[model samples]
Target: MPKSKTKKRSGTDATENRPKRSRQSQGGTPVNSASQGGGDVEARESPLQGHKCLWIMGSSIVHWAERTARLDDPQLGFTKHNMSVKWKGCRGLVFDGLDKLMDSMLMEMPKPQFILIHCGSNDLTSEGVTGKMLIEKIQCSILRYQALFCKTTIIWSSILQRRYWHYAPLGAGKKIEKKRTRVNIAIKSFILKNGGQYIDNNNISAKEVNLFHTDGTHLSSLGNSILINNWKTALQSLINSTPDNSLLTLPTATL
Candidate 1:
């Protein structure tokens, strides 16, 4: 007898006969189907994504640096989203006050990837807070930031010089200017020793200052732009030194 011939089923028939996937049934729960894979993928990505730039202002800087960053370099990627009062009313306050301010600011916006600290001029000119005290305050701020957010790049601007040197009861005009220089020197030293960055506006001349501002105290629109531009350069320099992968390992801890 001739072998019996068998006919193959049509594709449509085979598909119709195949096992159907149930909407509610589990091969794996739909909600969790990609959970493991997605989580692993996210874990592999760097934690520094969405990091924020924070500007912390002392009393003088509250009026100066913060305003400059806001109006001049809105593009600098820093927001008043974080501010701290390191000094008060034309004078530097107690060192403890700075500590408190840093703690509170960090708690409120903890993941700052970059921090700009502007102070010391007030300390020297107003309260006569010594270079040692200023250094202590700066060191405390650095240590606190490092302990809480290791990835943050801290930038401290050098003490700015003044056009009007005499504030009654302080001293002769030139004497005050001398004090400003001393404070600026101390600030630069502290920055260098601590592995932080500094921006020197002290070297900015009277002619340059006049171009940026009408008032001796604050900068004009052009001045603000200059200030922000300098700061941007410093920020870029810091970024160039840090690697994306390494930033992920930055510590996040409570003060």
Candidate 2:
């Protein structure tokens, strides 16, 4: 985590003033401070609007989806179909990784109508974890989210297969590549089984040179275009659909 500065003020004064917000890094999480016990404590609020879509993912999303999203070009009209786009991008973070991002950032946030979840790139590198086991963990997490956020629609983006996997030490890269494929299949199945949507990155291909950077760890400019377009397509449909709040009145995963 990056260190941040918090402005201190008198308790009385703090009550009248809204907390200040600052970004942790160039494209990292936003750090905010609220008054607490004569000091400021880091805090976060729901960044999403009541009706906009939220994208929660890791570094690849930071480079691909978020980069396109942050472009303030007026001609682009960042807003799509009345949706206020929000991105929670962190490098090397996963739902179950060291950061435990899902628990810390999402659990208590204001629920949105749509969300795109793409994580587990770092989890693929964890030792002794098989693809099937990883998928099971992710499934349980989604089930909990459904139980909690009944009206919110979740779209799980597949873990992308990188081109540089062959460059990894010994057989690690190859192993990761194979596991990614299996995990993707499992994710798609789980999402559908639980009545969730799965986004299969259409640009994932060996011939898509513009999709990845030199290290094969991040997305190139062209990659961002492809990803953002995909998001727009998926979001348009959901935004146009009539939402049923009672979809998850009971834990559907148990069924």
Candidate 3:
């Protein structure tokens, strides 16, 4: 994470701060938080108006991509639909750290109708973490979160295939890539089987020119754009998938 001064306090939302909210999405899931740039102010100023709220949460992948998504752009359809979007990104976030991430945000904003999670690439390179082990941990977390969050829809974003595996030995790249595929497949199957949704990001792989930075770990400008585009598309598709607008009514989270 690019260390910065603690962020200024973002004030109350326009919507009535409800007690625990039920979550739902077109396909399923939500987006979250503020971006690295001053997008936090932009999100705070928008009135949620009880419409669909999406919280996009993840690692720096999300932090770097919010400006490109521009969900807060008033001229965009997202604004017209009266949906609220929040992006919560952290540079060094890992898979198991998601619980802590959400816990930290609980009191900051209203519950979102969907939570679109795009993380886990870092865990693949972490010491002693195996693909199967990560998947099992993820399953436990998902079920526990579903129980605690109640109706909150959880959407899994597939980790994009990386050309370089940061922190691993030079020869470990191919092995890590294979693990990435297995992790994605296993998690996707689990999420779908459990009535959740998945965002497939295989298109933004290393094969694409300039999609990744020279480090091959993070995304380049064009790559972030593609990533956000896929997210926006998923948000729209999921929002419109089910006609159960009644499910959009949310309760506040218990602090």
Candidate 4:
């Protein structure tokens, strides 16, 4: 759960069973960005009530966070924000796999208010893949998702730099880095142009050493914390900037 309210643009009268601040978030803008752990002072206990939902989707980086930080735990960081937060990711998942994953999600959950995607790193490392090819595929997939979920917002997260390219040959780090940069720039451009938010992870690099694990593909604990903080900042800005949402607070109910 986030320390923010669900930005519900359209829906039937959802039972208002959240806190007072969440109810207020609907009429006015919210400005709380719980940078890092423990979130905001408004955070509440489990079983929050909300109409909109959030989904954080990706591969290793996301999966690692969920495994170590339980980032998806709906009760972990519920500040006045009234949306249920869920995490979906796994190790070695590629871009195409992401499409399948999201499609599968439709069968299990309602349309989400936001979906944060942080995948494509694995595909970047796979032999014979070029940035151009990957970018085209990603563009199609993202567009499909956007068209299907007309009301939902899409957040395109950039790929992180790796100390090592898993499937590439020795000393191919630089080549992979170049491709990754090109892919990120191109993707970022498309996302911004076509109505999507972008989160850049260039601040976290393999060069930092402290930010990465020995495996070089995953992030260290401290690294994940930083990544999450960045997300908080970006998402809070996006949430607060949106206009005209009405929220209500009824008795608390199980998620």
Candidate 5:
């Protein structure tokens, strides 16, 4: 397993100051953290005001949104959390566990009307996982979520290509990129087939990646803003398409 390059904060700082929260209680099965006031606050205020978009993120998404929330939108009332583990990667067994965790979380909270999923990069980096296996894992995760939360709209973000070779073993990075392309092709097919929506982040530049991170693997404040801008455009389209309650009636996926 690859160790996280990021440093861990002191326990006091972690408990007191972290804005991004896990739905699970510490050492427990994942459950929505309403008592902690860490989920969507907008949903709490009148329930009819803003669209409750739950960002079910991977490590990359967590890295991006944590920086972005602090710098750009402190008032942006959305829930950002991670289920992805570094080096464990996005395999069938990993996603099977994620499905159970997510199912437990949804059962406790009102189902989120909108879900944004950013994952699969780690799956490409894993040694034993194949593109076919990655796709099947994602498919299973999606179907499981759909069954649990029948009305949620899902936005599947495309795996953003690396700005430069960040992985090792000579030709390994290229091979990973090739596999990523195949995984994305499968994701696009599945999204189109299931009436879900896709967001392509491959168009983001190396310069943008640099601005977003000190390292290639994570996002900086600037990088997070780029993500939010891109995602917000897609979200606005969905909000414009129907009334708020109609959002709950929309298909399981929307871009």
Candidate 6:
């Protein structure tokens, strides 16, 4: 198949329109363009290796270097690299989150054959956001990714439970936990119904696994192992069933 033409944003250079970084440049700012609805559109690329799998997500992924390197082992034929931007609560939903990621990936030296995306916990944590709305946003994001990277199989990772979610002042944390549950349900339904692969991080971490830091927003070391192992299982399942890459090619999982 021919390479898909990359969609462009306003203020993008007509010639290349690529970000300056190699794999990813972690930061708090958005890219240098504007979307149709006035969302910021910054995307940075990582150093490209010969691997065809690309993982993209928010800041939480930056800390998974050791585990991700395991995916690059020659036997697996998967090279994992991340292209994450700065994260703030609900900013991903407000901005064209996946679009930014696509821009970032295309800027890279290698195009991915499989793309895994794990994000939107911030959106779910934001107050007053309905599970339905979060579901819609995620579904739309998946469609956008498929449209741009039609040849790649997209795997959607579930939002994890925050261990400290119930400790926030005024019971705000409890509310967040509820919202997360609702959103996760919607996400699982949507992904499975749409023929996209969904990894249930919640279930994997629920079994006496201390999966988060004391702050409850990030993954602990053991949690990282659990997350990566889940990704491995998901990918391995797909590979086992589809010995020939007919409809889907597997990709790296983003945290």
lDDT of 3 at 66: 72
| Order of candidate numbers by TM-score, starting with the best | 4, 3, 2, 5, 6, 1
lDDT of 5 by residue, 1-255 (tens): 124467632211001122232121111011111111112122222143344545444444545464455565532433332111111113222333555545455554555665667776656656577788889888766665555445566567777655433433444655776787888788766764564656665434443434335445555555565555555555545554644323222222211
Candidate 3 regions off by >4 Å? 1-49, 70-77, 244-255
> Compared with the true structure, what per-residue lDDT tens digits does model 4 show for residues 126-175?
76778899999888887887766665667877888776565576566677
Q: Which stretches of candidate 6 lie over 4 Å from their true place?
A: 1-51, 61-96, 166-169, 204-209, 243-255
lDDT of 3 by residue, 203-237 (tens): 56565546666555677767775666666666666
What is the lDDT for 69 in model 4? 57
Model 3 lDDT at residue 2: 28
Question: Residue 193 lDDT in model 4?
Answer: 64
In model 3, where is the ten-residue run with the lowest total lDDT? 34-43
Lowest lDDT sum, 10 consecutive residues, model 6, at 24-33
Candidate 2 residue-wise lDDT, 1-255, digit = tens = 122225432111101122232111111111111111111223334465554545555555554566565674321243645555556777666557523554555554555556578788767766666777888888777776665455556677777666554223543555676788888888777676666766666444434555655554556656565555555555444454444422221111100
Report lDDT per candidate. Answer: 0.44, 0.54, 0.64, 0.64, 0.49, 0.48
Candidates in order, TM-scores: namely 0.59, 0.67, 0.73, 0.73, 0.64, 0.60
**Cα-lDDT of candidate 6:** 0.48
Better of 2 and 5 by lDDT: 2
Question: Which residue ranges in model 1 land beyond 4 Å of their true spot?
Answer: 1-52, 62-73, 77-97, 165-171, 206-215, 242-255
Cα lDDT of model 1 by residue, 1-255, tens digit:
112235432111001121222111101000000001010111111244554555544544345545555553544543342322221122244344655566555555435555566665545544466556666666666655545555555566655554432232433445555666766676566555554556665324333444223334445554445555555555544444444322211111110
RMSD, each candidate, Å?
29.9, 16.2, 14.3, 16.3, 13.3, 15.4
Residues 1-255, model 6: lDDT tens digits: 112234432211111122332121111101011111122333333335533454544434333523343455422333233322221122233324656655665655344545657676656545565667777777777666655555555666766655443223444555666777787677666655555566666433332325444333455565665566556656655545543433433343333
| Residue pairs clashing, model 5 | 212-219, 212-220
How does model 6 score by TM-score?
Answer: 0.60
Better of 4 and 6 by lDDT: 4
Error of 3 at 165 (Å): 1.4
- Candidate 5's C-alpha runs over 4 A off are 1-53, 74-97, 164-168, 207-209, 242-255
Give the residue spans of candidate 2 off by over 4 A: 1-50, 72-80, 166-168, 171-173, 242-255
